[model samples]
Target: MLPALSEKELDRLEDLLITYGNDYSVLNLAELNGFFTALASSPNRVNPEQWLPAVAGGKVPKFKKPAHEEAYTALMLRYASQVAEELADDPEHFEPLFEQSEGEEGPTIILEEWCFGYMRGTQVAEWSELPPEQDRLLKAISLHGLEDNFELLDSMSFDEHQACVPLVVEAAQGLYQYQKQHRH
Candidate 1:
């Protein structure tokens, strides 16, 4: 499976996002990856008009430098285009982008933030219920997203989700396939 971004690109992208400030800045690199991955299988082209403002917290962002603006736009376009291509060519093997990040709050937090991106990305375009074939994956990502309770998880569930990581990876791939096959 193709990786969404090289380690260096991922690091550079993360740094750029953080420097720019907005929803992108709030999320860690893993979350950023998860969000874009979710959007990869969308039937529609990833709409910069919609996402730039969303990433900027619903307001138009003004970049400090023209170079930063160019980099941000180029990086986002590459992310969307490359992810879709990867999902189409090798959905089963596409690597998850979470490993690029090393956050203090650990995997759970990363998972939670990733879902935030997933949920948000999916909503950027109009969509209905997923196909019956994808129900398991839908439920998995939805449940994972909802796991964002204000309180921290107790020890058992925490380990459970950590162990569930493989399933999450598979589900994400399944989701990519489902979206591709059932395009509206």
Candidate 2:
């Protein structure tokens, strides 16, 4: 099994992403986690050739050194593999890397970026026309991730959105199991 990314490595990856300079298009760490989780759960394999460019906001970054580029790419591939292994071996304990912010009440869990990343992954994987049951499972992530659902989400109170977090997690795990059982 590939080693998990250390905190320092993770930070370095984040820095590399930040250096990409297209804030609107580039994904952050949380989004990358969600994106990778979706790809990991996908029934059809999505190669690095397809997904790696998306990591850099739809363009491959031109690193200063060939070694630096190789290192970051290797790190990303390893992280993606780590996500897949965790979901396959221990879906129950799999966790999405959501952000936490201190709200007036307390620390608030933010699922937006992660969810958005996941939805993007689905798009990249071309996961279209799933069965109703599977579509339902995907919806759990979409509710929190998609821009189209913002109005609906806006209608929900903070507590309500907070309550839905577990549902999203469960949905991701369920999707992984479904794909595992029904892989083509």
Which candidate achieves the best lDDT against the true structure?
A: 2
Q: Across residues 67-156, which tens digit of lDDT does each residue of candidate 1 receive?
A: 888877777667767766766778889876654244454634236666666766777665577667677776666555655543433444
- Among the numbered candidates, top TM-score falls to 2
For model 2, residues 76-149, the per-residue Cα lDDT tens digits are 88888878888888998888889899998698999898999899888888886778988998999999888999
The lDDT for every candidate, in the order shown, is 0.66, 0.85
Give the range where candidate 2 is weakest over 10 consecutive residues by summed lDDT.
Answer: 19-28
**Model 1 lDDT at residue 181:** 72
Residue 17's C-alpha lDDT in candidate 1? Answer: 69
True-structure RMSD, every candidate: 3.8, 1.5
